[model samples]
Target: ARNAGIERATSEWIAFLDSDDYYWPEGLSTLRLVATLTGASIVCGMLSDADPGRLVPEELQVSIADQFLAVMAFRGVVPPLSMSSSAIRRDVVDTVGTFSRSHGTAEDREFWIRAAARFPVGIAFRPVAHYRIDHGHGKNDAHFASGAKLYVLRRIFREVIQNPVVEARLRSDPASDVFYRLHQSHLLCLDAAIRIRAGEMISAASTLSDAAVLCHTADELYCLIRELAYFLTFPRSDPYAATLRCSRWLVTLARETARSGDRRLTDALLVRASDAIYYTARQLRRSCGEQLAWRTVIAGLRVVPTIRSAKSFLRFLAESPRHTGHSLMYPRNQRG
Candidate 1:
């Protein structure tokens, strides 16, 4: 849809704003002054998210192609100005190419990456637009929360960052390995996130195992774990709520990591995750009745096969009612 709009544009500059979003009164004029002064093919203005008081421009910051590309590639954090607040020179669009239909939710990020690789990008720290976030859909661009962005991450990994020339350029940098690992970890964690959301535990486990065993070294694997930790956001909401959110994923990740030949890391993670889930299950039993909590207990037991879990299993067997499996044959009021 954006590409189609670009095709029909006949101006020297193209600024994109969605129907639901709007530009500040000084937005276009601010970008125009900066574009004319800096000669940047792409000019990005800050939105309300950058800083509430950062609406006035002090200076137009020019981002070097290599530095910009490296930041996006390695840091796994995108503080770049967004499309809603950016204006690109009409001619640059042809070379940077159209917004990719294949990148799913990351087309904008992917486009800026490609643009930074070739053309100069200018940043104005003034608020240029009031962009609305659709919280209900789980699309937060600031931190890359959308699992759909995995499409473009895969492409950049395969096509841009791993290209021989690109790799050679970063090889001389002292922090190259750190940068590379962080970016690599984002790919690993995001892929895991998508699979887990889709209920494809086997696939997610296999991917994590491959990363731990085949794809990464010790340092790199640690980066992967750290990135995964940030994504999970457990322990904060933790003993019960946090456990309910992140412990299951940790348990799954630990199981797979252990299978990939690292038993040492498994114990601590498994214990924490399983303990929380186990306690939550027992609590559920008090309020929701036995049958519902039984399922939670079963999940906890799957995570950690400890003596406590065994005891809980036996206790439930002796105290809980059995499932005859024929109660549905009769009406609900008449069934046992």
Candidate 2:
């Protein structure tokens, strides 16, 4: 299909977009300018998740070097492309061959991996497309079960480690480091989760050991570790409050990091934090009841930002002896 689309090209430049999105008035002009300046085979802009309401760009405009390094240390920046907002040079596509249909759900991410392997990539951080998010029947509703997530993680890891082209890309370039680390931590986290879920006690221990060896404790790897630790340490009935506390705090941390211009690290941090919240909520909600769980979630969300002050926040966090009964003794970690 991509071949057919390329073969019937109507112009020297061709752009890509999914059916559910719209191009902004500035998109073409921006693409042209980026193409002229970079002489790049591909040009990309931001993607908005909300309706003129919420604009989320595909490219974050922070320091690329820091972003790449952080991702290498941990899996950060796993998602980059907004298909509707990206433009590709005709010659580049023809030279590289079209997208393969075999990749399944991660087709876009896989394409970027292949493209970055071959040519110089460029990004434009301006909002170029609007991605309608709340469409009730949209494809975004897919349930990311623990089982499915495990499969995706394994495939990503296998591809990154075993593919010769990808390995070569990693060896020579600093820019590719983010993708490598981002995928690496992802695999480790998912592998750990799978072992625990499958009741493979020895296997889970082995994977966790390997993960520790690989330096997966970076902030990006924290959420996975937090989850794995929670599941392994706490009773099924008691994890929500603790999980909620961690999730709220982690999100606040990510936001602050992004605001501070360290978004690459923050991005990875956000994913780990997000996964922690998700699994915790899913596991607890079914057994413990959402209403009861949400009260704690709401309380944690309220207090996280205040914790930035540290001094007072620490006192407050430590006031309860154990925050949310999860044994979160924050002021203890902060004593100078």
Candidate 3:
């Protein structure tokens, strides 16, 4: 649907909005200012679950350069920006190609990977749109219930991971080790998660053991938990529901990974799994409503009362990074 709209748009600068999401006027202005100042083919602002003047009050990092893929693959969890909060020049769009119909739920992430590789992506610290999450459940085998989300993820890896262009760009980057570590960790976790979902305990356990070895720090494991939650993508009504599911998956896999391995690694996975829940719950202070927001918080922290604080949580608001996401540099001379 978005691709069709892109085909029909007559404007040189194209922006998108979903039915449930709306752009903030100030946010659009910020994006335009960033694009104009930087001549970036793509510019993105933050997204708020509620309509807000800004997502956060603190001064946030605003990036301008061809490091979108670096940030994305390094972060290894979510996209650096939401497409709803982003605008692209027509020429860049034509060059990068439209969103993939094949990805279904993750087309935006796929598009960002391709576009960001070709152009520098500009980031402006502002809330660009009110992002209403999908919380509705599937009834009687509808709405991504029948293993469709997994299939979409598999397809995404097949296309983006196999594409030589993005892979080469990432490999050539100076920060290639961290990018590969994070990226590889996520891929391993994805395979393990799929195994856990399929009741393949032995396979899931073996994969988790390898994933633990690949993850060098608690921070990496923190991102891994978040990645699993984001990848789960179902029952989105509660932000932490995915984390809870991730925790369960980890515990189940841990039970199996424990059978044979360093007991310390097994213990580490259990600890990180619990910690991830607390961290996510603490971070999601949605402006939607106090009651609902706390529900997400309480749901997470209630399980394991140990909460660890980190400034990195603010990135969720400032970056609006979704599932692994991109760079485009638009030149002023090319525009009419």
How many clashes does each candidate structure show, in the order listed?
A: 0, 1, 11
What range of 10 consecutive residues in model 2 has the weakest lDDT sum? 62-71
Q: How far is 98's C-alpha from truth in model 2 (Å)?
A: 2.0
TM-score of each: 0.51, 0.56, 0.73
lDDT tens digits by residue: candidate 3, 1-336: 888888899988999886657777666777888888778888887776654654444354466866453434434422256768889999877776788775557677778877877688887765667766553333412433466666666567556756655777667778667666666666777787677678787887777667667777766655565565455544555556666776666666667767896575566556666666545544454444333433444444444333331222233224443323111111122222
Cα lDDT of all candidates, in order?
0.59, 0.52, 0.62
Clashing pairs in 2: 75-182
Compared with the true structure, the alpha-carbon lDDT of candidate 3 equals: 0.62
Model number with the top TM-score: 3
Our model 1 lands, by Cα RMSD against the true structure, at 13.2
TM-score of 1: 0.51
Better of 2 and 3 by lDDT: 3
User: Weakest 10 consecutive residues, lDDT, candidate 1?
Assistant: 134-143
Candidate 3 Cα misplacement greater than 4 A, ranges? 51-61, 67-73, 76-79, 134-144, 167-185, 215-221, 240-242, 254-276, 279-288, 292-302, 305-336
| Selected candidate, larger TM-score, 2 vs 3 | 3
lDDT of 1 by residue, 1-336 (tens): 899989899998999996545788777898887787778888877665322343355554534233343335443322355778889997777775778786556577667766665566666766677654221223433224444345556666556675444455467667666556555555766687668767787687766654544324544444455445444543332223444566667777677767766674455456555555665555455434455556666655765577756776566545544445443222244344
- Tell how far residue 133 is off in model 1, in angstroms: 2.8
Please give the lDDT score at residue 48 for candidate 1.
Answer: 52
